[model samples]
Target: MAIELAGRPHRVPEGSSLADLLAALGHAPQACATALNGDFVRREQRHATRLAEGDRVVLVQPIVGG
Candidate 1:
């Protein structure tokens, strides 16, 4: 299936979970915040949240400031 990840089109395996997508993209589950189709998905839910075709995923990482 194909999904819009951070505004770019990407393909993932069928029945892929958010955690799987993150692993495929080289992101650590604990290092970023994720939103699915404009709604926030908690960290613990990543493993259970299955992504569908055309779903929008946004990943944001925390930045340290002075």
Candidate 2:
């Protein structure tokens, strides 16, 4: 499936969850915020939020800068 993450196209496996996607992208699910199809996906829901075809997923990591 072709899902867009942070404005970049990504090919993720079928039935992959937010956690799975994050892991594939070399990111830790514990350290990021996720949005699927324009709706914010909470941490508790990441395991259950399955990615669908043509779904747009945006994952942004928290950054602290002085």
Candidate 3:
């Protein structure tokens, strides 16, 4: 299946979850914020958030500033 990952088209195995995609991409779940289809997804929900084809996934890094 293919999904829009960070604005680019990315292919992933069927039944891949947000957590699975993160691991496959070498990203730590705790290192960034996750969103599916423009809606924010909590850390604990990643494992249960099944990804569907063409789903929009966005990963945002933390901004540290004062």
Cα lDDT of all candidates, in order?
Answer: 0.95, 0.86, 0.96
Residue 35: error of model 1 in Å? 0.2
Please name the candidate that would achieve the greatest lDDT relative to the true structure. 3
On residues 1-66, what C-alpha lDDT tens digit does candidate 2 reach at each position? Answer: 888877778888888988888888788768889899899999989889898878898887899998
Which one wins by lDDT: 1 or 2?
1
TM-score of each: 0.95, 0.87, 0.93
Estimate the overall C-alpha local distance difference test score of candidate 2: 0.86
Off by more than 4 A, model 1: none
Instruction: Put down candidate 3 lDDT per residue, 1-66, tens digits, no spaces.
Output: 999999999999999999999999999889999999999999999999999999999999898999
**Which 10 consecutive positions of candidate 1 have the poorest summed lDDT?**
21-30
* Tens digits of lDDT, candidate 1, 1-66: 999999999899999999999999898889999999999999999999999999999999999898
Cα error, residue 57 of model 2, in Å, equals: 0.8
Give the Cα RMSD of candidate 1. Answer: 0.7
